[model samples]
Target: MTNLRIRAVEAGDLIPVDLPAPRPDVDGARWRRTRVAVADGQIVGIASVALSAATDSYFCEVEVVPGHRRRGIGTQLYAAVHRLTDPRFPVLARAMDSFPLRRRFAEALGCSVVTRCPAPWIDPPTPAAESWATGQQAPAGYRTTVIGDRPLAIVKDAWASSFAWVHRAFGAVHIDRIPQMWDQYSKGVDPAASAVAVDRNQTIVAFSLVSPDAWDGRTFIVAETAHPDQAHGTQVLGATVATSVTVLARRGTRRVQLEGHTTDRHTPDVMRSLPAVGSDPMDILRLEPPPAVSRGGCR
Candidate 1:
């Protein structure tokens, strides 16, 4: 940690150190602060936190370059986070199951696992598209359209409303964060594969969001949902996914990846039936508050 300075900076400052571009699942407004551990004019570590209005806590992430790790750089960055952020609110962190060292590091930092969610990558058999082909038909009074063809405001609103039906162990998603989330991740979404179901009234009732894999060029179904208010919501959900698959298959995309969350009740059973080829589930950790000291005088 010698000659390292942990100073506050904008989120973009960490981009050089593998800070991912803003993600659609994460709301930019929730970002509270970011700090970089700079040494010799280069960033050696980074720590950032975003506020979850629903939980009233900060979700933090810290990283130290491979060469700089084990030198207390991460610890110092976190200490800087503690010094800058509100102490009344708790801090949370995430650890991927595939990285045992990450979990151990979180545990060593006095964090406890609060939730575990599977990040399964579903690679449906080529025949799955054929078997589910019939699902492409929209329910009566509903028609399917590509998400890119519709207004973003309309799509974002529909996604937020429909997602309310989902139950997650962590907590409900903040509707206010949907727009920014959509803005960040929508750029990568495949306009041709992502579809939405619209009612006769032109209201969006269901949607399937898809994107290409950055590494393999295959398709990845980012998200799919149907508004619970629709009488045929379930069917619409099926149709959207079916349509995406049919289109993908026609394009010679025999394999598709869909991430499933074990703690999410909304994941369809059909999706769960697919083989999980991704890393182990992710561990959401929370830093437990210290025990309260006695307020009364000692006897």
Candidate 2:
């Protein structure tokens, strides 16, 4: 044994191990703090789950230091998280299409492969701009409304449900942790910059969360989307995309990009339905686990 101990992350204890910035929503829900594994008093692994308000859906993230591979730290940390969420609601973890190790770990925990959306980039469409100038109005009802704190919960539920369906169809486990999603979004994106669409009843039908990134040179990244479930799903999706493009253009963004798994044709169709939206291929992989009799259980 490596004498590793798993415990909650404390104030001033986070030292920027090997993962991206700490997600905001996960951190804010002080009750659902992150868990870190340490060996010899040095941080070696980390994992955390953000529990959702609706049902037992939680979003999770895990990271193991480069030097700590092959040890059971990753598994242990995940197991501990599972225990915390066990007998409650199902937990879902989101791994980047490029992170194979994490994906494999998820599978080992009895998670199935889910739907993949492609990450597509969009520049000011010159040809489309010309067409628009000729009176080709932006997609109908494709308007953008600011996302306020009041409507966040509803929007989050809608987003979680949509993603859960897509993942389930692909045979992947679904954990819709709302707090974690909110944390990641709040830290990485600007809420004021995000927008949602509403029907006549003022119900939020669709939305797009966007973040401005300077590293990619004034780029806008569509963090997520939730379209209505009614007959207007396609239209709602189109309006959300068009509204995002308009917002990014006004902010002086040179380009806009949305990242998702793109192996499926439906992914491309979803993007194409929106005016000026284009698709391109991106690399992604899912690693499998060794055959075993025991499958991890979801809360």
Candidate 3:
């Protein structure tokens, strides 16, 4: 019983659960948090229901005391998290394939496997300047411009239609995610970190959105978008990374990842550019609402 402490929370429990701080990126009204403390006032577990644009639903996370195993704290914490689900949008989680128990526990919570996602990675000190210079050999008529080099409003409108194209190309199972609009893609985004390739007529042909993976700004994720073809893919990928590399180097960041669903289209020319590819297959789990709840769930 090594100083373990846990109890049901109530209005006057006097237990100081360290709730997660509010994040502006998450939808404020839908965001939720819970914490259960242990002996010495340390966190034994925490359950959070946050926004996941990819799932078009709330994503869940349950943290437990490190190095404490063979205990039921995780089960208890997830039970509490299950109670917070809205049942309208799909409540989902990305269970790591490396951890079999994570998938088992999620199943216990009524989640079922949906699909796997690939999390590709790239090392620091990207390709030299000359190989991927600004506008390096863009499609004959195409040139390069960054997010901030052009007006924000025009850029948004130009790329608005491209979002649908990207979604179609990927055909993600969570079709609701795919950034249907520029506004959804721009939140918590650094304008300077993203890249856009445009034609002489002032039209966006291909683009890439790269932003710090977290507040630390040391690592970035690049979401590439372009027409479905080899030549266009190579051109867009090179130019986009080139533009974003400059932005990242300025911030002293040397690592970047290109994350996408397993079903998304892949171009060898683009993939070969960054040899270090780490595919973390995320097993998405989803649960349908109960019959009664499903009947009344719709607004």
Candidate 4:
């Protein structure tokens, strides 16, 4: 075993670190520094947080080298990230189904199991020409359009209103924690890949954001979805999925996969609507300092 050390990531180290494939538009949004764990001068674990401008909330991701499992390294890494967080910021973490220990670790913190589902994968389903054509039919008051940087402000506002329920369901601390969500999206790798549905007045009613997966050459991930209100929820979701399918088809991609918590209820609806996709499992976890302590070090 090597001596373990944890520190903030540096510029030179940025390119080499195996970061989770970012959604296409993350660059426009700002990201906080990531913390990495090194052992014997080699990096072994990593963790970082992202804030969504539309929601003003933060979510975290953490990973550890396979060989170093069962130690408290994951826990320590989580605590370190939590230390830098604002107490009012609602934080979320996903533990893949393969990682049960990580789930337990998250429970030891204050997070509850919000949702779970099979990790779903979508490949070019034999494009049902009829269904594809049907999807192109714009809903009665809504028209589909590609989102551009100029309209990001309106989209962000609508997104916040539409996804507000998600924060309540997930125990998010507060909105406004992340101010760069839409801005980052505006600068994403392929803005053309994103689409939004708007009403007659040109008010954005729904939107979907997608990005290419660096690890899997042909796959693109759906990063975010927002709608004008709950009444239009299903329409927004359907439009988002359809838009992704259409884009992937045009790009000649054969498959797509969306990461979903194994416990979330919406997974079923997602599967039912897009039956061609198959669900697999992923794990999600979150860690926070014990309530009695104000910070990782202590009150």
Best by TM-score: 1
Please state the error at residue 25 of candidate 4 in Å.
21
TM-score, every prediction: 0.70, 0.61, 0.65, 0.65
RMSD of 2: 6.8
Q: For each candidate, what is the lDDT?
A: 0.63, 0.55, 0.55, 0.56
Better of 3 and 4 by TM-score: 4
List candidate 4 segments past 4 Å from native.
1-43, 49-58, 83-91, 98-111, 116-119, 128-137, 146-154, 171-179, 214-233, 258-271, 280-284, 288-299
| Winner of 2 and 4 under lDDT | 4
Name the 10 consecutive residues with the lowest summed lDDT in model 1: 290-299
Clash counts per candidate, in order, are: 0, 19, 0, 26
Clashes of 4: 26
Residue 109 Cα positional deviation in candidate 1, in Å, after optimal superposition: 1.9
Alpha-carbon runs more than 4 Å astray in model 1 = 1-4, 9-32, 39-42, 52-57, 88-90, 128-145, 163-177, 198-203, 214-220, 224-236, 252-255, 260-264, 275-280, 288-299
Return the TM-score for candidate 1, rounded to 2 decimals: 0.70
Residue 211 Cα positional deviation in candidate 1, in Å, after optimal superposition = 3.0
TM-score-better candidate, 2 vs 4: 4
lDDT tens digits, residues 10-29, model 3? Answer: 34434223444322323443
Instruction: Give the CA lDDT, 0 to 100, for residue 237 in model 4.
Output: 53
Query: lDDT per residue, candidate 1, 20-130, as tens digits?
Result: 332322344555677788888777777777776545567877787787788878777777776655687678777776677666666656776666655455444456455
